[model samples]
Target: MQILANIIPYFISQVENFSRRERISFAYLSIENVLGFSKSDCILKNDFKINKKDIKSLINIVNQLKKNVPIQYIFEETIFYNLKFKLNKSTLIPRNETEELVKWVLQYKFNSLFDIGTGSGCIPISIAKNSNSIISALDISLDALEIAKINAMYHNVKVDFICDDIFSYIPKRKYDIIISNPPYVLKSEKVFMSKHVLDHEPHSALFVDDSNPIIFYERIIKLSSDYLNDNGMLFFEINEKYSGDIIKILSKYNFVDIELKKDINDRDRMIKAVMK
Candidate 1:
Protein backbone atom coordinates (compact mmCIF):
# COMPACT_ATOMS: atom_id res chain seq x y z
CA MET A 1 0.00 0.00 0.00
CA GLN A 2 1.24 3.45 -1.04
CA ILE A 3 -0.19 6.73 0.21
CA LEU A 4 -1.27 9.37 -2.35
CA ALA A 5 1.37 11.83 -1.14
CA ASN A 6 4.19 9.28 -1.64
CA ILE A 7 3.03 8.37 -5.14
CA ILE A 8 3.02 12.02 -6.34
CA PRO A 9 6.71 12.51 -5.42
CA TYR A 10 7.53 9.24 -7.20
CA PHE A 11 5.82 10.60 -10.34
CA ILE A 12 7.82 13.84 -10.12
CA SER A 13 11.06 11.87 -9.81
CA GLN A 14 10.27 9.44 -12.66
CA VAL A 15 8.91 11.88 -15.26
CA GLU A 16 11.99 13.94 -15.89
CA ASN A 17 11.01 15.40 -19.27
CA PHE A 18 8.20 17.65 -18.00
CA SER A 19 8.74 20.91 -16.23
CA ARG A 20 8.04 21.12 -12.48
CA ARG A 21 4.60 22.61 -13.13
CA GLU A 22 3.68 20.06 -15.81
CA ARG A 23 4.91 17.20 -13.68
CA ILE A 24 2.68 18.41 -10.87
CA SER A 25 -0.28 18.69 -13.20
CA PHE A 26 0.41 15.20 -14.53
CA ALA A 27 0.63 13.95 -10.99
CA TYR A 28 -2.75 15.29 -10.02
CA LEU A 29 -4.39 14.24 -13.28
CA SER A 30 -2.98 10.73 -13.04
CA ILE A 31 -4.02 10.31 -9.42
CA GLU A 32 -7.54 11.47 -10.17
CA ASN A 33 -7.83 9.33 -13.29
CA VAL A 34 -6.51 6.20 -11.60
CA LEU A 35 -7.79 6.63 -8.06
CA GLY A 36 -10.78 8.97 -8.46
CA PHE A 37 -9.12 11.32 -6.00
CA SER A 38 -9.74 15.00 -6.58
CA LYS A 39 -7.04 17.57 -5.90
CA SER A 40 -8.77 18.46 -2.64
CA ASP A 41 -9.02 14.80 -1.79
CA CYS A 42 -5.31 14.38 -2.40
CA ILE A 43 -4.54 17.29 -0.12
CA LEU A 44 -7.03 16.64 2.69
CA LYS A 45 -6.69 12.87 2.58
CA ASN A 46 -3.02 12.77 1.81
CA ASP A 47 -2.81 9.47 3.65
CA PHE A 48 -5.36 7.82 1.34
CA LYS A 49 -3.96 4.42 0.43
CA ILE A 50 -3.42 3.49 -3.21
CA ASN A 51 -3.41 -0.28 -3.65
CA LYS A 52 -0.59 -2.03 -5.59
CA LYS A 53 -2.59 -2.62 -8.78
CA ASP A 54 -3.67 1.03 -8.97
CA ILE A 55 -0.13 2.14 -8.22
CA LYS A 56 1.11 0.02 -11.14
CA SER A 57 -1.39 1.67 -13.45
CA LEU A 58 -0.32 5.14 -12.31
CA ILE A 59 3.30 4.19 -12.93
CA ASN A 60 2.44 3.09 -16.46
CA ILE A 61 0.68 6.38 -17.05
CA VAL A 62 3.66 8.30 -15.71
CA ASN A 63 6.05 6.38 -17.98
CA GLN A 64 3.95 7.29 -20.99
CA LEU A 65 3.89 10.91 -19.85
CA LYS A 66 7.70 10.83 -19.75
CA LYS A 67 7.65 10.02 -23.46
CA ASN A 68 5.59 13.20 -24.04
CA VAL A 69 2.43 11.22 -24.74
CA PRO A 70 -0.57 13.48 -24.10
CA ILE A 71 -2.53 12.52 -21.02
CA GLN A 72 -5.75 12.47 -23.08
CA TYR A 73 -4.36 9.79 -25.38
CA ILE A 74 -2.99 7.87 -22.45
CA PHE A 75 -6.42 8.03 -20.82
CA GLU A 76 -8.21 7.71 -24.19
CA GLU A 77 -10.65 10.49 -23.30
CA THR A 78 -10.85 14.21 -22.59
CA ILE A 79 -13.43 16.80 -21.51
CA PHE A 80 -14.59 19.10 -24.31
CA TYR A 81 -17.34 21.68 -23.89
CA ASN A 82 -17.94 20.11 -20.47
CA LEU A 83 -18.60 16.74 -22.15
CA LYS A 84 -16.31 13.71 -22.12
CA PHE A 85 -14.96 12.80 -25.58
CA LYS A 86 -13.07 9.60 -26.39
CA LEU A 87 -9.80 9.95 -28.29
CA ASN A 88 -6.94 7.91 -29.77
CA LYS A 89 -3.76 8.46 -31.74
CA SER A 90 -6.01 8.77 -34.79
CA THR A 91 -7.66 11.93 -33.40
CA LEU A 92 -6.21 15.24 -32.34
CA ILE A 93 -6.85 16.23 -28.76
CA PRO A 94 -9.59 18.86 -28.60
CA ARG A 95 -8.41 22.33 -27.60
CA ASN A 96 -9.93 24.95 -25.32
CA GLU A 97 -9.91 27.41 -28.22
CA THR A 98 -12.27 25.03 -30.00
CA GLU A 99 -14.58 25.24 -27.00
CA GLU A 100 -14.65 28.99 -27.58
CA LEU A 101 -15.65 28.32 -31.17
CA VAL A 102 -18.47 26.02 -29.98
CA LYS A 103 -19.60 28.67 -27.51
CA TRP A 104 -19.73 31.27 -30.28
CA VAL A 105 -21.65 28.92 -32.56
CA LEU A 106 -24.16 28.11 -29.81
CA GLN A 107 -24.90 31.82 -29.41
CA TYR A 108 -26.80 31.58 -32.68
CA LYS A 109 -29.95 29.58 -33.51
CA PHE A 110 -29.84 27.01 -36.28
CA ASN A 111 -31.58 23.73 -37.07
CA SER A 112 -28.97 22.03 -39.22
CA LEU A 113 -25.17 22.00 -38.88
CA PHE A 114 -22.24 20.36 -40.64
CA ASP A 115 -18.70 20.10 -39.28
CA ILE A 116 -15.69 19.62 -41.55
CA GLY A 117 -12.55 17.75 -40.42
CA THR A 118 -14.46 16.65 -37.36
CA GLY A 119 -11.68 14.98 -35.33
CA SER A 120 -13.20 12.92 -32.54
CA GLY A 121 -16.44 14.57 -33.70
CA CYS A 122 -15.95 17.06 -30.91
CA ILE A 123 -17.37 20.07 -32.71
CA PRO A 124 -20.65 18.64 -34.03
CA ILE A 125 -21.08 16.22 -31.13
CA SER A 126 -20.70 18.98 -28.57
CA ILE A 127 -23.31 21.00 -30.44
CA ALA A 128 -25.59 17.95 -30.72
CA LYS A 129 -25.35 17.42 -26.96
CA ASN A 130 -26.45 21.00 -26.39
CA SER A 131 -29.06 21.67 -29.11
CA ASN A 132 -31.77 20.03 -31.14
CA SER A 133 -30.00 20.18 -34.49
CA ILE A 134 -29.43 17.92 -37.46
CA ILE A 135 -25.64 17.53 -37.17
CA SER A 136 -23.27 15.91 -39.63
CA ALA A 137 -19.47 15.66 -39.60
CA LEU A 138 -16.85 14.48 -42.13
CA ASP A 139 -13.27 13.31 -41.79
CA ILE A 140 -10.70 11.87 -44.17
CA SER A 141 -9.47 9.10 -41.87
CA LEU A 142 -11.68 6.10 -41.25
CA ASP A 143 -9.87 5.45 -37.97
CA ALA A 144 -10.60 8.98 -36.83
CA LEU A 145 -14.22 8.71 -37.91
CA GLU A 146 -14.52 5.45 -36.02
CA ILE A 147 -13.32 7.23 -32.89
CA ALA A 148 -15.74 10.05 -33.59
CA LYS A 149 -18.58 7.57 -33.94
CA ILE A 150 -17.68 6.07 -30.56
CA ASN A 151 -17.65 9.51 -28.98
CA ALA A 152 -21.03 10.45 -30.46
CA MET A 153 -22.47 7.13 -29.24
CA TYR A 154 -20.95 7.62 -25.80
CA HIS A 155 -22.53 11.06 -25.52
CA ASN A 156 -25.82 9.66 -26.84
CA VAL A 157 -25.77 12.42 -29.44
CA LYS A 158 -26.86 11.83 -32.99
CA VAL A 159 -24.23 12.95 -35.49
CA ASP A 160 -23.97 11.61 -39.02
CA PHE A 161 -20.26 10.87 -39.31
CA ILE A 162 -18.97 10.62 -42.86
CA CYS A 163 -15.60 9.35 -44.00
CA ASP A 164 -14.54 11.29 -47.08
CA ASP A 165 -11.99 13.72 -48.33
CA ILE A 166 -13.63 17.15 -48.25
CA PHE A 167 -11.79 18.41 -51.33
CA SER A 168 -13.50 15.76 -53.44
CA TYR A 169 -16.80 15.14 -51.64
CA ILE A 170 -19.83 16.96 -52.96
CA PRO A 171 -22.51 18.13 -50.55
CA LYS A 172 -25.76 16.18 -50.71
CA ARG A 173 -27.71 18.70 -48.63
CA LYS A 174 -27.62 22.28 -47.46
CA TYR A 175 -27.15 23.21 -43.82
CA ASP A 176 -28.13 26.20 -41.71
CA ILE A 177 -24.61 26.34 -40.25
CA ILE A 178 -21.34 25.00 -41.69
CA ILE A 179 -18.52 24.96 -39.15
CA SER A 180 -14.96 23.61 -39.20
CA ASN A 181 -11.82 23.65 -37.11
CA PRO A 182 -9.71 22.52 -39.99
CA PRO A 183 -5.96 21.93 -40.03
CA TYR A 184 -4.36 25.34 -40.32
CA VAL A 185 -0.99 24.94 -38.64
CA LEU A 186 1.72 25.55 -41.21
CA LYS A 187 4.60 23.11 -41.47
CA SER A 188 6.91 25.95 -40.65
CA GLU A 189 5.00 26.52 -37.42
CA LYS A 190 5.85 23.02 -36.21
CA VAL A 191 9.03 24.35 -34.71
CA PHE A 192 6.95 26.31 -32.23
CA MET A 193 4.74 23.42 -31.12
CA SER A 194 5.39 21.20 -28.15
CA LYS A 195 6.91 17.76 -28.57
CA HIS A 196 3.81 16.03 -27.20
CA VAL A 197 1.67 17.44 -30.04
CA LEU A 198 4.26 16.87 -32.75
CA ASP A 199 5.05 13.35 -31.65
CA HIS A 200 1.65 12.06 -30.55
CA GLU A 201 -1.17 13.78 -32.52
CA PRO A 202 -2.05 13.03 -36.13
CA HIS A 203 -0.19 15.20 -38.65
CA SER A 204 -3.06 15.31 -41.15
CA ALA A 205 -5.16 16.98 -38.43
CA LEU A 206 -2.49 19.57 -37.60
CA PHE A 207 -0.03 20.64 -40.29
CA VAL A 208 -0.56 22.40 -43.61
CA ASP A 209 1.92 23.11 -46.36
CA ASP A 210 3.64 26.43 -45.80
CA SER A 211 3.13 27.45 -49.44
CA ASN A 212 -0.61 26.70 -49.24
CA PRO A 213 -1.51 26.98 -45.57
CA ILE A 214 -5.16 27.80 -46.09
CA ILE A 215 -5.94 24.97 -48.48
CA PHE A 216 -8.55 23.48 -46.18
CA TYR A 217 -10.10 26.90 -45.64
CA GLU A 218 -10.44 27.53 -49.37
CA ARG A 219 -12.15 24.22 -50.10
CA ILE A 220 -14.54 24.52 -47.13
CA ILE A 221 -15.43 28.11 -48.02
CA LYS A 222 -16.01 27.23 -51.67
CA LEU A 223 -18.22 24.31 -50.70
CA SER A 224 -20.09 26.44 -48.19
CA SER A 225 -21.59 28.57 -50.95
CA ASP A 226 -23.39 25.54 -52.34
CA TYR A 227 -23.98 23.69 -49.08
CA LEU A 228 -25.30 26.56 -46.98
CA ASN A 229 -28.88 27.77 -46.97
CA ASP A 230 -29.78 31.41 -47.46
CA ASN A 231 -28.37 33.45 -44.56
CA GLY A 232 -26.54 30.35 -43.37
CA MET A 233 -23.43 30.80 -41.25
CA LEU A 234 -19.88 29.54 -41.75
CA PHE A 235 -17.58 29.36 -38.76
CA PHE A 236 -13.89 28.45 -38.65
CA GLU A 237 -11.21 28.07 -36.03
CA ILE A 238 -8.44 29.90 -37.90
CA ASN A 239 -4.73 30.32 -37.75
CA GLU A 240 -4.24 33.93 -36.67
CA LYS A 241 -1.44 34.44 -39.16
CA TYR A 242 -3.81 33.63 -42.01
CA SER A 243 -6.83 35.55 -40.71
CA GLY A 244 -6.46 38.29 -43.31
CA ASP A 245 -6.22 35.75 -46.12
CA ILE A 246 -9.28 33.85 -44.87
CA ILE A 247 -11.29 37.07 -44.64
CA LYS A 248 -10.36 37.86 -48.24
CA ILE A 249 -11.45 34.41 -49.39
CA LEU A 250 -14.78 34.72 -47.57
CA SER A 251 -15.40 38.17 -49.05
CA LYS A 252 -14.62 36.89 -52.54
CA TYR A 253 -17.26 34.18 -52.06
CA ASN A 254 -19.79 36.92 -51.23
CA PHE A 255 -20.03 36.04 -47.57
CA VAL A 256 -21.28 38.90 -45.38
CA ASP A 257 -21.23 39.91 -41.74
CA ILE A 258 -17.77 38.36 -41.43
CA GLU A 259 -16.31 38.53 -37.95
CA LEU A 260 -12.94 37.54 -36.47
CA LYS A 261 -12.96 36.50 -32.81
CA LYS A 262 -10.05 36.20 -30.41
CA ASP A 263 -9.73 33.26 -28.05
CA ILE A 264 -9.04 33.56 -24.33
CA ASN A 265 -5.36 33.80 -25.17
CA ASP A 266 -6.36 36.89 -27.19
CA ARG A 267 -5.33 35.33 -30.49
CA ASP A 268 -7.59 35.81 -33.55
CA ARG A 269 -8.37 32.11 -33.65
CA MET A 270 -12.06 31.98 -34.70
CA ILE A 271 -13.96 33.58 -37.58
CA LYS A 272 -17.56 33.63 -38.83
CA ALA A 273 -19.16 34.60 -42.15
CA VAL A 274 -22.74 34.59 -43.36
CA MET A 275 -23.87 33.23 -46.71
CA LYS A 276 -25.27 35.98 -48.89
Candidate 2:
Protein backbone atom coordinates (compact mmCIF):
# COMPACT_ATOMS: atom_id res chain seq x y z
CA MET A 1 0.00 0.00 0.00
CA GLN A 2 3.03 2.27 -0.36
CA ILE A 3 2.20 5.41 -2.39
CA LEU A 4 4.13 6.35 -5.58
CA ALA A 5 6.13 8.95 -3.68
CA ASN A 6 8.04 6.15 -1.95
CA ILE A 7 8.03 3.61 -4.81
CA ILE A 8 11.72 3.77 -5.89
CA PRO A 9 13.24 2.61 -2.61
CA TYR A 10 10.38 0.16 -2.15
CA PHE A 11 10.79 -1.20 -5.69
CA ILE A 12 14.54 -1.55 -5.21
CA SER A 13 13.90 -3.52 -2.04
CA GLN A 14 11.39 -5.71 -3.92
CA VAL A 15 13.80 -6.52 -6.77
CA GLU A 16 16.66 -7.85 -4.68
CA ASN A 17 17.17 -10.86 -7.00
CA PHE A 18 18.26 -8.63 -9.88
CA SER A 19 21.74 -7.08 -9.95
CA ARG A 20 22.21 -3.60 -8.56
CA ARG A 21 22.52 -2.25 -12.12
CA GLU A 22 19.35 -4.02 -13.19
CA ARG A 23 17.55 -2.72 -10.12
CA ILE A 24 18.59 0.85 -10.93
CA SER A 25 17.51 0.44 -14.56
CA PHE A 26 14.11 -0.87 -13.48
CA ALA A 27 13.70 1.99 -11.06
CA TYR A 28 14.42 4.54 -13.79
CA LEU A 29 12.02 2.88 -16.21
CA SER A 30 9.35 2.70 -13.51
CA ILE A 31 9.52 6.42 -13.01
CA GLU A 32 9.42 7.12 -16.73
CA ASN A 33 6.75 4.65 -17.79
CA VAL A 34 4.77 3.95 -14.61
CA LEU A 35 4.87 7.40 -13.04
CA GLY A 36 4.96 9.40 -16.32
CA PHE A 37 8.07 11.26 -15.26
CA SER A 38 11.44 11.95 -16.88
CA LYS A 39 14.83 10.62 -15.65
CA SER A 40 15.51 14.10 -14.31
CA ASP A 41 12.21 14.09 -12.44
CA CYS A 42 13.22 10.87 -10.70
CA ILE A 43 16.22 12.77 -9.28
CA LEU A 44 14.40 16.01 -8.50
CA LYS A 45 11.28 14.40 -7.03
CA ASN A 46 12.22 11.18 -5.27
CA ASP A 47 9.02 11.28 -3.29
CA PHE A 48 6.68 11.86 -6.23
CA LYS A 49 3.49 9.92 -5.49
CA ILE A 50 2.21 7.35 -7.95
CA ASN A 51 -1.45 7.39 -8.95
CA LYS A 52 -3.53 4.40 -7.85
CA LYS A 53 -4.33 3.34 -11.43
CA ASP A 54 -0.66 3.15 -12.47
CA ILE A 55 0.27 1.05 -9.44
CA LYS A 56 -1.09 -2.05 -11.16
CA SER A 57 0.89 -1.15 -14.27
CA LEU A 58 4.07 -0.75 -12.22
CA ILE A 59 3.53 -4.08 -10.52
CA ASN A 60 2.98 -5.76 -13.90
CA ILE A 61 6.15 -4.27 -15.33
CA VAL A 62 8.18 -5.34 -12.33
CA ASN A 63 6.79 -8.85 -12.61
CA GLN A 64 7.69 -9.02 -16.29
CA LEU A 65 11.18 -7.77 -15.51
CA LYS A 66 11.46 -10.49 -12.91
CA LYS A 67 10.58 -12.95 -15.67
CA ASN A 68 13.47 -11.48 -17.73
CA VAL A 69 11.42 -9.74 -20.39
CA PRO A 70 13.51 -6.89 -21.81
CA ILE A 71 12.45 -3.40 -20.84
CA GLN A 72 12.28 -2.50 -24.54
CA TYR A 73 9.74 -5.29 -25.13
CA ILE A 74 7.69 -4.17 -22.14
CA PHE A 75 7.63 -0.61 -23.47
CA GLU A 76 7.31 -1.70 -27.17
CA GLU A 77 9.46 1.27 -28.17
CA THR A 78 13.07 2.46 -27.88
CA ILE A 79 15.36 5.31 -28.87
CA PHE A 80 18.04 4.83 -31.53
CA TYR A 81 20.26 7.55 -32.94
CA ASN A 82 18.13 9.86 -30.81
CA LEU A 83 15.03 8.79 -32.83
CA LYS A 84 12.20 6.73 -31.38
CA PHE A 85 11.46 3.31 -32.96
CA LYS A 86 8.58 0.89 -32.43
CA LEU A 87 9.39 -2.71 -31.50
CA ASN A 88 7.81 -6.17 -31.16
CA LYS A 89 8.81 -9.83 -30.94
CA SER A 90 9.10 -9.87 -34.73
CA THR A 91 12.26 -7.74 -34.87
CA LEU A 92 15.62 -7.77 -33.15
CA ILE A 93 15.93 -4.98 -30.61
CA PRO A 94 18.41 -2.32 -31.65
CA ARG A 95 21.76 -2.42 -29.79
CA ASN A 96 24.54 0.02 -28.96
CA GLU A 97 26.96 -1.87 -31.24
CA THR A 98 24.60 -1.27 -34.14
CA GLU A 99 24.59 2.40 -33.27
CA GLU A 100 28.39 2.34 -33.66
CA LEU A 101 27.94 0.77 -37.08
CA VAL A 102 25.60 3.60 -38.06
CA LYS A 103 28.09 6.16 -36.79
CA TRP A 104 30.86 4.56 -38.83
CA VAL A 105 28.73 4.63 -41.97
CA LEU A 106 27.81 8.26 -41.37
CA GLN A 107 31.52 9.08 -41.57
CA TYR A 108 31.44 8.45 -45.30
CA LYS A 109 29.35 10.11 -48.03
CA PHE A 110 27.10 8.24 -50.41
CA ASN A 111 24.24 8.79 -52.85
CA SER A 112 22.26 5.54 -52.53
CA LEU A 113 22.07 3.00 -49.69
CA PHE A 114 20.53 -0.43 -49.07
CA ASP A 115 20.14 -2.48 -45.88
CA ILE A 116 19.56 -6.22 -46.01
CA GLY A 117 17.83 -8.05 -43.17
CA THR A 118 16.44 -4.71 -42.08
CA GLY A 119 14.73 -5.72 -38.86
CA SER A 120 12.44 -2.93 -37.67
CA GLY A 121 14.27 -0.91 -40.34
CA CYS A 122 16.40 0.71 -37.62
CA ILE A 123 19.62 0.62 -39.66
CA PRO A 124 18.34 2.26 -42.83
CA ILE A 125 15.86 4.58 -41.15
CA SER A 126 18.52 5.93 -38.81
CA ILE A 127 20.97 6.46 -41.67
CA ALA A 128 18.34 8.17 -43.83
CA LYS A 129 17.47 10.59 -41.08
CA ASN A 130 21.07 11.77 -40.87
CA SER A 131 21.96 11.76 -44.56
CA ASN A 132 20.26 12.95 -47.74
CA SER A 133 20.92 9.58 -49.37
CA ILE A 134 18.04 7.61 -50.88
CA ILE A 135 17.46 4.47 -48.80
CA SER A 136 15.98 1.01 -49.42
CA ALA A 137 15.68 -1.68 -46.73
CA LEU A 138 14.43 -5.27 -46.73
CA ASP A 139 13.45 -7.97 -44.24
CA ILE A 140 12.06 -11.44 -44.86
CA SER A 141 9.39 -11.08 -42.19
CA LEU A 142 6.33 -9.12 -43.28
CA ASP A 143 5.49 -8.57 -39.62
CA ALA A 144 8.89 -7.05 -39.05
CA LEU A 145 8.49 -4.93 -42.17
CA GLU A 146 5.27 -3.46 -40.83
CA ILE A 147 7.02 -2.32 -37.66
CA ALA A 148 9.77 -0.83 -39.80
CA LYS A 149 7.17 0.93 -41.90
CA ILE A 150 5.60 2.36 -38.80
CA ASN A 151 8.97 3.65 -37.57
CA ALA A 152 9.77 5.13 -40.98
CA MET A 153 6.45 6.90 -41.08
CA TYR A 154 6.80 7.96 -37.47
CA HIS A 155 10.16 9.56 -38.25
CA ASN A 156 8.75 10.90 -41.54
CA VAL A 157 11.60 9.38 -43.52
CA LYS A 158 10.95 7.60 -46.80
CA VAL A 159 12.56 4.12 -46.71
CA ASP A 160 11.50 1.70 -49.39
CA PHE A 161 10.79 -1.47 -47.39
CA ILE A 162 10.71 -4.82 -49.17
CA CYS A 163 9.65 -8.16 -47.73
CA ASP A 164 11.80 -10.84 -49.34
CA ASP A 165 14.60 -13.23 -48.59
CA ILE A 166 17.96 -11.65 -49.31
CA PHE A 167 19.42 -14.75 -50.98
CA SER A 168 16.81 -14.47 -53.71
CA TYR A 169 16.65 -10.71 -53.82
CA ILE A 170 18.00 -9.02 -56.92
CA PRO A 171 18.41 -5.29 -56.59
CA LYS A 172 16.93 -3.12 -59.37
CA ARG A 173 19.93 -0.81 -59.22
CA LYS A 174 23.36 -0.56 -57.70
CA TYR A 175 23.98 1.27 -54.45
CA ASP A 176 26.85 3.38 -53.21
CA ILE A 177 26.52 1.75 -49.79
CA ILE A 178 25.20 -1.63 -48.65
CA ILE A 179 25.01 -2.69 -45.03
CA SER A 180 23.61 -5.43 -42.83
CA ASN A 181 23.69 -6.71 -39.21
CA PRO A 182 22.70 -10.20 -40.23
CA PRO A 183 22.46 -13.41 -38.18
CA TYR A 184 25.96 -14.10 -36.88
CA VAL A 185 25.36 -15.94 -33.64
CA LEU A 186 26.51 -19.53 -33.66
CA LYS A 187 23.70 -21.91 -32.72
CA SER A 188 25.90 -23.13 -29.88
CA GLU A 189 26.38 -19.60 -28.57
CA LYS A 190 22.76 -19.39 -27.48
CA VAL A 191 23.67 -20.33 -23.93
CA PHE A 192 26.07 -17.42 -23.72
CA MET A 193 23.41 -14.88 -24.73
CA SER A 194 21.00 -13.50 -22.16
CA LYS A 195 17.80 -15.47 -21.62
CA HIS A 196 15.71 -12.37 -22.28
CA VAL A 197 17.32 -11.98 -25.72
CA LEU A 198 17.04 -15.69 -26.52
CA ASP A 199 13.42 -15.86 -25.45
CA HIS A 200 11.95 -12.54 -26.60
CA GLU A 201 13.81 -11.39 -29.74
CA PRO A 202 13.29 -13.09 -33.09
CA HIS A 203 15.74 -16.01 -33.25
CA SER A 204 16.07 -16.03 -37.04
CA ALA A 205 17.44 -12.50 -36.88
CA LEU A 206 20.06 -13.61 -34.36
CA PHE A 207 21.46 -17.10 -35.01
CA VAL A 208 23.32 -18.92 -37.76
CA ASP A 209 24.52 -22.52 -37.84
CA ASP A 210 27.58 -23.02 -35.65
CA SER A 211 29.41 -24.57 -38.60
CA ASN A 212 28.82 -21.46 -40.70
CA PRO A 213 29.06 -18.43 -38.45
CA ILE A 214 29.73 -16.13 -41.40
CA ILE A 215 27.19 -17.49 -43.86
CA PHE A 216 25.17 -14.31 -44.07
CA TYR A 217 28.34 -12.25 -44.21
CA GLU A 218 29.64 -14.32 -47.12
CA ARG A 219 26.38 -14.09 -49.03
CA ILE A 220 25.83 -10.44 -48.25
CA ILE A 221 29.40 -9.53 -49.19
CA LYS A 222 29.13 -11.39 -52.53
CA LEU A 223 25.75 -9.89 -53.28
CA SER A 224 26.95 -6.45 -52.24
CA SER A 225 29.70 -6.42 -54.86
CA ASP A 226 27.10 -6.87 -57.57
CA TYR A 227 25.06 -4.02 -56.15
CA LEU A 228 27.86 -1.74 -55.00
CA ASN A 229 29.21 1.01 -57.20
CA ASP A 230 32.99 0.78 -57.63
CA ASN A 231 34.86 2.01 -54.55
CA GLY A 232 31.54 1.95 -52.70
CA MET A 233 31.46 0.47 -49.17
CA LEU A 234 30.03 -2.58 -47.47
CA PHE A 235 29.61 -2.38 -43.70
CA PHE A 236 28.69 -5.06 -41.19
CA GLU A 237 28.03 -5.08 -37.46
CA ILE A 238 30.13 -8.22 -36.96
CA ASN A 239 30.71 -11.05 -34.51
CA GLU A 240 33.80 -10.23 -32.51
CA LYS A 241 34.99 -13.83 -32.41
CA TYR A 242 34.97 -14.04 -36.20
CA SER A 243 37.26 -11.09 -36.77
CA GLY A 244 39.86 -13.26 -38.49
CA ASP A 245 37.26 -15.40 -40.25
CA ILE A 246 35.43 -12.34 -41.52
CA ILE A 247 38.60 -10.68 -42.70
CA LYS A 248 39.68 -13.81 -44.59
CA ILE A 249 36.28 -14.07 -46.29
CA LEU A 250 36.32 -10.43 -47.30
CA SER A 251 39.89 -10.80 -48.63
CA LYS A 252 39.04 -13.87 -50.71
CA TYR A 253 36.12 -11.95 -52.20
CA ASN A 254 38.38 -9.06 -53.32
CA PHE A 255 37.54 -6.44 -50.72
CA VAL A 256 40.02 -3.74 -49.74
CA ASP A 257 40.40 -1.24 -46.96
CA ILE A 258 39.05 -3.96 -44.71
CA GLU A 259 39.07 -2.88 -41.09
CA LEU A 260 37.57 -4.19 -37.88
CA LYS A 261 36.16 -1.82 -35.28
CA LYS A 262 35.06 -2.19 -31.68
CA ASP A 263 31.85 -1.11 -30.01
CA ILE A 264 31.59 1.29 -27.08
CA ASN A 265 32.11 -1.79 -24.93
CA ASP A 266 35.52 -2.05 -26.63
CA ARG A 267 34.53 -5.46 -27.86
CA ASP A 268 35.28 -6.24 -31.50
CA ARG A 269 31.77 -5.98 -32.99
CA MET A 270 31.98 -4.34 -36.44
CA ILE A 271 33.83 -4.60 -39.73
CA LYS A 272 33.97 -2.49 -42.91
CA ALA A 273 35.26 -3.18 -46.41
CA VAL A 274 35.15 -1.94 -49.99
CA MET A 275 34.41 -3.83 -53.21
CA LYS A 276 37.78 -3.86 -54.96
Q: Could you say which candidate leads in lDDT?
A: 1
After superposition, the stretches of candidate 1 with alpha carbons farther than 4 Å from their true spots are: none
TM-score of 2: 0.94
Instruction: Give the alpha carbon lDDT tens digit for every residue of 121-180 in model 1.
Output: 999988998899999999999999999999888889899888999999998899999999
lDDT of 2 by residue, 1-276 (tens): 255456667567777657878887777777787667877776687666666778878888878877888889989988998989999999889998898899999999999999999998899999999999999998899999999999999999999999999878889999999999998888898888888888888999999998788888888888887889999899998888888988988898889999889888888898989986
Instruction: Tell me each candidate's TM-score.
Output: 0.96, 0.94
lDDT minimum window of 10 residues, candidate 2:
1-10
**Alpha carbon lDDT of each predicted model:** 0.92, 0.87
User: Whole-model lDDT, candidate 2?
Assistant: 0.87
